[model samples]
Target: MAPRRCPCGTGLTYDGCCGRLHDGTATAGTAEQLMRSRYSAFAVGDPAYLLATWHSSTRPGRLELDPDVRWTGLEVLGTTGGSLLAAEGTVAFRASRLDDGVPGVQAEDSRFVREGGRWVYLDGVPLR
Candidate 1:
């Protein structure tokens, strides 16, 4: 993934947006916070973080980053209960991307699960 503007419309890289959260930062105190950082991680092509935060049961074996793709912004549309001790939860959002050729959005109703003290992304329902 190429470096690109953040949701704030700043030229700063996504690594600068929420990468800190994945790097031992204590900024993420809630599921929503973690969700935002995960989005930023996707934007920055930080598969390591994505995997680390993912619950082992649902985590994929690997991630393939698109060299030509760039993430533009993320919008958290809604979030339902997913308590710190809960086994499952959901989040709805829209993630915009560009391939240096065409632009598109990935709207999803994402599912999550808590294992130990971490929240891992499960599958999601894509909303075109």
Candidate 2:
């Protein structure tokens, strides 16, 4: 069987794309990349990766992923800043999922920051 593509809409194999980031072998180079990997983390139910990539200043004491949510798709809407030399950035996207057979979508504009030389998720503001 062929490897599945990443949920981040990157058109690359999961192993070659977000999987590398999840496994600690690669770090996100951009805010969009971090957003993608974070989405992948949700899809795979890996809270450790999710928390690890979150900015400490905004990180919650604990994370509780909904096991009932089955992620289905990802669509990136836009991005700002988040370059290798930039300190802050934002990525807007829509993530679709199934909540116990009911379809739902999560649209948000996420913020990111570089802490200790690596990109990490800051927070998200809903797009509604």
Candidate 3:
């Protein structure tokens, strides 16, 4: 069987892209990379990876993904900072999904920060 493509929209296989991050074999080098991996986590239904990458300041006690929602695509609109040496950054993206067969898109400007030398998700501002 062929390897599955990464849902983060990177032109790479899941294992070569977000899967390595999700499985702990690698760590995200930048905030944008972390953000993409998080989107892939949601697409693949792995809440554990999502929670693990969440910043401690904003992480919830637990996460429950809606089984009826299927993530279809991720488009990174822009980025500011969040590089390998930066302590913080923001990613603007639009994520497409289907909720019980209803199509929808979520646009947000998400913030990220470096914690313990690893990038982690901080929070996001919903875009109108």
The TM-score between candidate 3 and the true structure equals: 0.98
* Tens digits of lDDT, candidate 3, 5-119: 9999989999999999999999999889999999999999999999999999999999999999999999999999998999999999999999999999999999999888899
Report the lDDT tens digits of candidate 1 across residue range 70-116: 88877888888766656677888888899886898889988877667
Q: Scored by Cα lDDT, where does model 3 land?
A: 0.96
Better lDDT candidate (1, 3): 3
Q: After superposition, how far is residue 96 of candidate 1 from its true place, in Å?
A: 0.7
Per-candidate local distance difference test: 0.73, 0.93, 0.96
Q: Cα lDDT for residue 97, model 1? A: 90
lDDT of 2 by residue, 36-97 (tens): 99999999899999999999999989999999999999999999999878999999999999
Model 1 alpha-carbon miss at residue 70, Å? 0.4
Report the C-alpha displacement of residue 79, candidate 2, in angstroms: 0.5
RMSD for each model, in Å, please?
4.3, 0.9, 0.5
Model 2 deviation from native, Cα RMSD in Å: 0.9
Off by over 4 Å in 1: 1-17, 83-87
